[model samples]
Target: MSKGPVLLTGSAGFIGFHTARRLLARGETVIGVDNLNSYYDPALKQARLERLQAEPGYIHHTLDLADRPGMTAVFAGHAPRRIVHLGAQAGVRYSLEHPESYVDSNVVGFLTVLEGARAVQAEHLVFASTSSAFGANGALPFSVRQGVAHPMTVYAATKIANEAMAHSYSHLFGFPSTGLRFFTVYGPWGRPDMALFKFTRAILEGRPIDVYGHGEMERDFTYVDDIVDGVIAALDRPAAADPDWDAAMPDPSTSGVAPWRILNLGAGRREQLMRYIAVLEEALGMKAELNLMPVQDGDVARTEADVTETRAALGYAPSTSIEVGVKRFVDWYRDFYGV
Candidate 1:
């Protein structure tokens, strides 16, 4: 018997595109869905889609997660046994300017995905969360056990909502679901809004790059390939209800009443913003003009991921160093942009 196709949302996205490519390489059929919204550059999304189209095992759908009917139709038509839900309105700063976008895409759109998963009885639903959910905690190496009720931005709040919504669905329907909280994911084919991409563009253009948090910010920058590996591992290993989970002191990462779990997928090595920029400069063979600036609102000074549980659960280990990842990204950027 043949394996059922995997329904991967955000197929044209940075992570989604790579995940789909990996699955196709492993001989798994992938049904890709994306709105290809103008959040950044639809042209870039189109370019990613064009690459996926070259694969024989890939099928594409131009649909938004907020479209309930469209999402339901996809579930009915595809009958996908597994799902990788990575589509969301993803910028922390952008959430402050346009909170409704986060609601439509992250909150409502997530509900649509859950409904589709429930309808299809998917073997496992692995969805993307963010390290920003650890807002205002001030905890070193943020762990899933820490309280996440204090989200600082609308984006984080929406992702927290996704966790809660998935938990409810998993408990009520007995379907397995895993949430991967990604740190600062960076590498080739990255989003233009991310710091790495923005800084690279500015440095190459000989423009001043804004050094936020007075250049004191730190991030566990996981490469896109490492993230995809963790994501696939989580998808292949369906979550199971914790038999020893106690109600009196419930663990936030796993549930006793549901087949639900959350894990941090990060490189586990915090790199300073200044050092990260230095590596990028080395890659480009140019120095950056830095504009030192205070921390932006709704921004944390540091984010470090505690991936102990992720490692134990999926044997996840991020192997890419920032220096190597930055060089790879610089090479891709130069080739893609003819710079």
Candidate 2:
């Protein structure tokens, strides 16, 4: 009995490309979708797609998630049993400039996915969330149980809305859905917008790098492979209505009546920004000229993940240290760019 193909959005994006590749390796038919917009460089997205195109089990569509009719057609045509909705206009700082893009892709695009999931009665729906949803909370190692009522940025607000929307769909349609709050995902074939890639490129080019929060910030910095492990595990185990869920003191991580839950997918260890830079410097063997700056709008000083629920539920453990991870990224960057 072959379950239908997995419909994966953002297939050309960094994490999506990795997830799609792993799925293909495990013999899963992956139906990939991505607009390949110029948010960063479309060439990078195209490069990723070229690799996936070589895999026999991979199918791709160049469509935006917000395109409701196109997405509906895909669901009807493919009949996907499971969906990994990873497409969104991603960027904390960019949200400050173009909030509409976040609303269109994250809000409107999410609605189309929920509709498609309902139409197919998807066995499981796993979507990407962000740790930035923990905005305005100075708590260490953020837990899924913490209330996400104060999202400081439009991007975070849109992801938080996706959780609520999925929960309602799960309750009304009797399908299972899981949301994963990823913390600072980075690795080979990484996005240029991320701190890791930017720092590496600047250091290699002998350019000064901007150190936000005056180099005092910290991040959980989960590697791409670890995140993919958590995603596949969560996808395999669908959410269920919590039997012991109490409405009096509702658990933010699970639902009382709905088969819906959220979990943190992170390394569960906080590393200082300076240490991460140092690791990158060691990898490139070049020191970065630092321009210390105040934290930008919609930026949190520090972010840590409490992945206890993730580990207990999915047996998830993130093993990559900054040293190994930075080295891998630098090696890939050099090879890819001929630097």
RMSD of each: 0.9, 0.8
TM-score of 1: 0.99
- Looking at model 2, which ten-residue stretch has the lowest summed lDDT? 1-10
Candidate 2 lDDT over residue span 1-339, tens digit each:
236799999999999999999999999999999999999999999999999999999999999999999999999999997999899999999999899999999999999999999999899999999999999988787999999999999999999999999999999999899999999999999999999999988888889999999999998998999999999999999999999999999999999999999999999999999999999988998888999999999898888999999999999988999899889999999999999
What digit string (tens of lDDT, one per residue) describes model 1 on residues 190-239?
Answer: 99999999999999998999999999999999999999999999988999
The TM-score of predicted model 2 comes to: 0.99
Task: Check candidate 1 and list the clashing pairs.
Answer: none
Worst 10 residues of 1 by lDDT: 1-10
Candidate 2 achieves a global lDDT of 0.94
